[model samples]
Target: MKTKSTTLLLTAITGSLILLLGSGCGKKTVMPPETTMDGGADAGTPISYPAAEGGGYSEESLPIEGSLDDTSTATSVTAAEGMAEPTEEYKKLYGRSTRGLSPIYFNFDQATIRPDMVAKMESNSEYIRQIPNAYVVIEGNTDDRGTNEYNIALAERRAQNTKQYLVDLGTDPARVRTVSYGEEKPLFFGQDEISYSQNRRADFIIE
Candidate 1:
């Protein structure tokens, strides 16, 4: 009887040990990366992943979308690079008129004008034509997305395209110049889609 009792106790202890081991060493689950190895996430939002069931990883609170200045480390371009400095008389007469025009937004990685934005561009052309001898500077900008070099080139294309369209609409090509600020000057500094969309545009800077 004593031998049978001892055997039962040993079995029970062994089962208890196995359960403890199983609970202590649970299987770990790893998540797949959000982007490819080359990192081709131009304007892609960073994913917010939840914690794993049994894995140990502390969550980090990163700053999200906000209406603030969030320009990256990009070199500033000068206005003189495109056009001469505005005269005091020019500023007094047409500064408010030109600066008051609303900026036209562009699509992701596109330099062409959108079908919906054609009317707005036409309005801009009319406004430019109204102000006779108005020195116009189209400042090209981009959202905080691509690399510095890529954004600069993209912005230049935007400014160039806008200038060409204005010229095509009877505006003087000599009077209109373009400067690419890339992602340096942001209208809306949020990291979300809305803010990024606002930032991707060409602004009319009356010189």
Candidate 2:
């Protein structure tokens, strides 16, 4: 009996020791890496996180569509040959007169009719003559070299001069309106003589 009791106690103690060792083995922690590598060498495996939801890249990082700007930066242009033109409406708008007559322009700084410009003005006047009720506005502008008040006066003189010329061609004076822009609206914006010359002219607007 004594021997059997001793054997039973030894078996219980052996099982308990085995259970303790197994529990301790699972509780051991793993070490992490100290540097970046392709794969993790330990339990703290390096995971690749994707770019942030909306803040990772810049517009410059995107693929360019067509020709870039003067700089190597990305710019948008027609990416495909068969793509429809984006400015089709603008081209059409400039193609024809929307109102009763197309506009007529004058020579730079000269309100006196030139022979070539007179022929074009006659054609434009015929448009109003065809539609007697048609009305138009003559807008005169000047270059940026003069004071605003002085330019306004000069522009008014040019506009009235054009209107008088049209009236002399048998168009009714009541059907015309005139406005002066006084160096306000330049056809081109630059400090050069070319731009100034462009702005020093008269244009007709039809309503």
Candidate 3:
């Protein structure tokens, strides 16, 4: 009976030792957390990705300033292009004489023929009558107070008024033509009142 009891105790101790060894072998070894390569962040902390290669723009790649000024310059060029071009007949009669009839002057921004210039128109009409099959171009001009476009329109009104007056004085309507010089062909260059008044005149060109 004593021997059997001793054998049972040894068998139980051997079985417990085997179970502990097997459990130790089955467990996995634990490793430490990895850090960023730059070592800037702590372990288990998130690191932002680097900026995309060549993705951002520099100052040199941006659009230029003063775009409004560029637009203004382009508009000025377009306005200049809109001005009237001279005709071949106008080029031929540009510097020709108008006999004794002088250039008729106007008041500031006025297209109406003054009473003083009535005689001049009559004389011009008589001179036209003297010459058979002669045509005359009345060139209207203005002072440099307004824009090219406004001055051109004003000049046209002046020329039309003068041409009508000549036609009323017995001159043939078909023999008369009109053009506007605007402020381009100034009779006097000074900015004073007298110069401006002289420049605001209608010139005669015989063709």
Highest lDDT scorer: 3
Q: Write the per-residue lDDT of candidate 3 for residues 56-98, one digit (tens) a residue.
A: 5454444433332242221221232343333323322332236
User: What's the TM-score of every candidate structure?
Assistant: 0.53, 0.51, 0.53
Residue 15, candidate 1: Cα error in Å is 99
Clash count for each candidate, listed in order shown: 0, 0, 0
By lDDT, is 1 or 2 better?
1
* Deviation from native of the Cα of residue 205 in model 1, angstroms: 1.8
RMSD values for the candidates in order, in angstroms, are 18.2, 13.6, 22.1
- Cα lDDT, model 1, residue 184: 85
What TM-score does candidate 1 get on C-alpha atoms? 0.53
What are the runs in model 3 whose C-alpha is more than 4 Å off? 1-97
- How would you encode candidate 2's per-residue C-alpha lDDT over 78-179 as one tens digit per residue? 444433332323222221233444344456656666676687678778877877666888877787876899888888888888889899999889999889
Model 3 is weakest, by summed lDDT over 10 consecutive residues, at 71-80
What is the alpha-carbon lDDT for the whole of candidate 2? 0.66
Q: Which pairs clash (backbone N, Cα, C closer than 3 Å) in model 3?
A: none
Predicted candidate 1 versus true structure: per-residue lDDT over 1-207, tens digit per residue: 999999999999999999998888767888755553356554355555555557644433322232123223122223335323434333323322355565777999999877886786788888877888778989888998989899999999998998898888888998988899899876566799977887788878677
